[model samples]
Target: MIVTVQPTGISAADVLAVARGDARVELSPATVEAMAASRAIVDDIESSGRPVYGVSTGFGALANTSIAPQRRAELQHALIRSHAAGIGAPMPREVVRAMMLLRVRSLAMGRSGVRPVLAQGLVDLLNHEITPWVPEHGSLGASGDLAPLAHCAIVLLGEGWVLGKDGARMSAAEALHGAGLRPLDLAAKEGLALINGTDGMLGMLLLAIEDAAHLFAMADVTAALAIEAMLGSERPFLPELHSIRPHPGQAASAANIHRLLQDSAIMDSHRDDLAHAVQDAYSMRCAPQVAGAARDTLEFVSLVSSRELVSVVDNPVVLTDGRVESTGNFHGAPLGFAADYLAIAAAEVGAIAERRVDRLLDVTRSRNLPPFLSPDAGVNSGLMIAQYTAAGIVAENRRLASPASVDSLPTSGMQEDHVSMGWAATKKLRTVLDNLTSLLAVELLAGVRGLQLRSPLAPSPAGRAAVAAVEPFAGTPGPDLFLAPVLEQARAVVAGRALRGEIEAAVGPLS
Candidate 1:
């Protein structure tokens, strides 16, 4: 499908489409107009001989130095080459695509004063699936993710390495030329306009935010399954109970849990079962509070992303009245804090999921379930070590949950003082997501095994659907087997595969 850029907004789904290589991109007329207005400002600045920050002078610690008009093009070229110093593993192609899209979108807003040709080059890269090989590290998350974005700018100049459609790394010149394109000669403020922004951090966070949203929904689904597996009370999720204190996320979580348990004979039958009693443990009862907090964090992140996405985050924004303004909009404190909050929320989910896993394994705590959820506790270890793995992941999450935003170190001889470390925060959140996914997967697998021991007692319809979704991926307990694939499949479901779709079709869409 043709994915035209609209000034109104871009969605996560559009990004996913581009990542999957099923979409083409086009610049909207509004974007073209914005670029034209921005370029006009640049022309006026150049023609009037006013010294703009990046356009006429050097960057960062070298900002005081001025460039001669004759060497301006060389300065722009060197700016990209000098900053293309990112290191570590290459980022995923999707992240590169996201970075390009974000940069293009920001430039399209017209405040950056980049020429229309430069913005269109980014769109062309996306449309042709030419992804720059950006490294995962080297950004302090302030001063606009300079290193990674420099790599992107280098690709535009056709000087860096980029991945072709066949996944082979080739020179950007070769990649572009092979597809009937040529390198761009950046005009005044074009290099700064392209490289000077939080798009690097913003791109990764955008993808992570979408993943976190899906995981939040999955958290509720997995919690519902565990609640039914333990035959826990449904009273805590009652609408009237949530309405008394009405936080939107909490109310929404309560509603989701209620919907998952609705029309379930297992839940209905256990409601009056005195053996299960009036209340469940805190892990079961406080699911809304923990999960809802994560949802709230995501809401805050969405707000921050919305602002940053459309903003002119580059230094030296060009006003329509032909005035140039140097500013620190490139500082990433907003995204830094948002990423830190995301880590905290994600850690909480893992922490609570670990508790649920513990509950499912401990025979006394698990009510009627066998020790370690094994039919033959002595002969088979069953899910004994799964809980250990879950605990280890949970412990790791606690360390990762430490806020990167709270810590900063001065860089660039202290001229670029107070780094945001927001990129670090976002990167750590990705790790936390991976750890949480595995931990939750382990729990789901263990809970299913425990439920299997319950046999004809059967879980709630939602729980049964969840179990059936995972059952095909699980194997009966055997000695010293590789359980990674089983854990992976469970992670896929917990990450929101359409396992619930079958049940949804028979019943209705899961709330």
Candidate 2:
């Protein structure tokens, strides 16, 4: 399918499509008109021989320095070459693609005064899969991801390197030549326009935020399964209980939990026969509060991401009235704070999930199930070690949860006196997500085991569908077996493969 860029909006799903190499870009007519208008203003500025920041003068600490018109092309080329200093491992292909798409979107907004041909070059690169080999590190996420973006921009001039389809690194010239493409020329602010934006950091954060949202939902579903497996009360999720102090996320989470457990014969049979009449432990009972808080965090992150995606986060924006205005929209503090918050919320999910895994493995807390849910206690360690792994991840998540946005270091001779460090936070959030996925998987495995012990009484339709999805991949617990594959399958289920159809079928349709 062809994905068009509209000034009205962009979606996370569209970004994913571009990353996956399905690129058919259509620029909005309004955006094209805006680009043409901005270019005219830039031409007038050049004709009048007036100096502009990053256009006729040097950048950042060297902004006071002037470049003569005779050396303008050399100046722009040198700006790209000298600033392409990103170091560390190459970023994933998807991140590179996202960076390209975001830059294209920003340029298409027509506030950066880039030429149409230069903007189209980015689209052409996306279409032909000629992705630049951008590195993971080097952006302080201030000054608009200058260094990392320079790496991306250099490819347009056929100066840097690009990754080939066969996983080989080739010079941009070779890649373009092999694909029947020609190198581009930077006219006026084209180089600065390409390299002066928050696209790099924003792209990474967008993907991270999207993943965090999915995991947030999965965290709630997994916690619900654990609640039933431990024979915990559903009273905590009652609408009446949450309505008095209604946080929308909390209320919505309660509703979702009630829906997930609606048809559980295990819950019904246990509620009637179990000796305890009051409520379950906080880990099982307050699952909504913990998971709902994460969902709320995602809600705020989504708002921030949506705004950043549409914003013209570049310096020296060209006004519609043909005026050039220098600004600091490039500052990444907003995104940095959002990424840190996301990490903290994701860590909480892991924290509570670890506790549920602990409950399932404990003899006293497991409600008459064998210790560690093992058939034979001594011969089989059962899920004992899995709980330990989950605990270890939870501890690590606590450390990773430290807010990266809270810390800052001076750079650019203190010209960039405050750094966002948001990229650092986003990177750590990805790690937190990895640990959370594994931790949730462990809890799912334990919950399924506990559910098996309660059988004869059927699980809820959602729970049964979840169990069936993993059953094909899970083996009966035995001595000293590897659990990685089982964890992977469980993760796939939580990520929308296993119970997705059943859940959607019941819920009708998802927005």
Candidate 3:
């Protein structure tokens, strides 16, 4: 698929296709016209010898200093090299691609006063599958992920490392030459244009939102199966029950659990019995409430992402009326707050899932299921350590959930005081989601075994499908043997969303 860059902007879906799906990119003629118009304004300003913030002067604390026209090209090159000082492991390929694509989107808007060739060069990089080596650190999320983006921008100058078409790490010079691409001599404000935006944090935010959608939907499915494994009541998920509350997420979750529990043999067996408790534990009964809140939080985050998608996030943006003015549109506080909020939501979802895993292992709370779901209580450890792993992750999530946006630190010689720490927030959000995936996998392992221990009573059709999907990877309930590999395999299944896919196949798509 080819995503055309236009001055009107692109959507989050378009970014996802380019970033993860390796979609080719092209500059619309309209974008070229916009860039040419903006470039004309910049060229006039340059020839007039008027001092603009980025076009004719130094940056940050050095903004007051002016440079002669002869050294302006060198200024742009020096800016990219100095800011490319990020030191850490390289960021993922998808993130770099997304960042590069977003930079193109910003420049295509003709707001940063760059020529059409610059945007076309970035598009060429994407089409050829050449990914720059960008480190994980060095972005304060103010001045819009400067250092990390500089690493990417430096590749355009043919002076950095890149993952080539074959995914091998090679010199940017070699990669560009081999691909029949020429190195760029960055003109006035071009380096600042390339590096100034919230693309890194925003890219992470978009990717996290996509993952959370699947994880949150599957969370409901896993909770439904856990409820069945514990023989919990489905009455709480009734539509009438959620109708009064009217939170869309809650209603959707309740509806999913209710649908999954339909015609459940175990539920039918307990429907008329007084022995089953009048109410289940909060973890089981309030599953929708917790997961639904996370759903709503993600909706808000998605809203923020949508706004950012159309934004021209550069330091000195060119206006339609031919004025290039410095602005703080590059600040990342919006994305930072959204990422922190999402981390909290993800952490809570994992916490509740962990609670359910604990309930399945506890003999007292798990109804009459064998201790730790073990066939022989004393002989085999069965899933006991899995609960421990889940608990540890939940604890770590609690720590990670401490909002990164709140701990603002000043940098750039105090010129950039009170930065948005949005990059840190997005990075932690990824970890929280990863841990959530693993935590839910542990729940799936125990929940499926608990349901299987019920024998002829039979789980709901969705539950049976979930069992079949997971059993191949995690193996059937029996004496514990080589449990770490089982947990890892189950993690892969959950991460791949195979369990959710099977459940959806059996009971239609979940919300």
* Cα error, candidate 1, residue 443 (Å): 2.2
Task: Give a tens-digit lDDT track for model 1, residues 267-307.
Answer: 77677777776778989999998898788888999899877
| Decoy 1 TM-score against native | 0.95
Candidate 2: which stretches are off by over 4 Å? Answer: 7-9, 166-168, 478-480, 506-511
Model 3 CA deviation exceeding 4 Å by range: 164-168
lDDT for position 256 in model 3: 93
Q: Against the unseen true structure, what C-alpha lDDT does each candidate score?
A: 0.81, 0.80, 0.91
Question: Model 3, residue 192: displacement in angstroms?
Answer: 0.7
- lDDT tens per residue, model 2, 292-358: 8888888998899899887988889998887898888988889889888888888988898899889
Steric clashes per prediction: 0, 0, 0
CA shift at 199, candidate 3, in angstroms? 0.6
What shift in Å separates residue 331 of candidate 1 from its native position after superposition? 1.0
lDDT of 1: 0.81
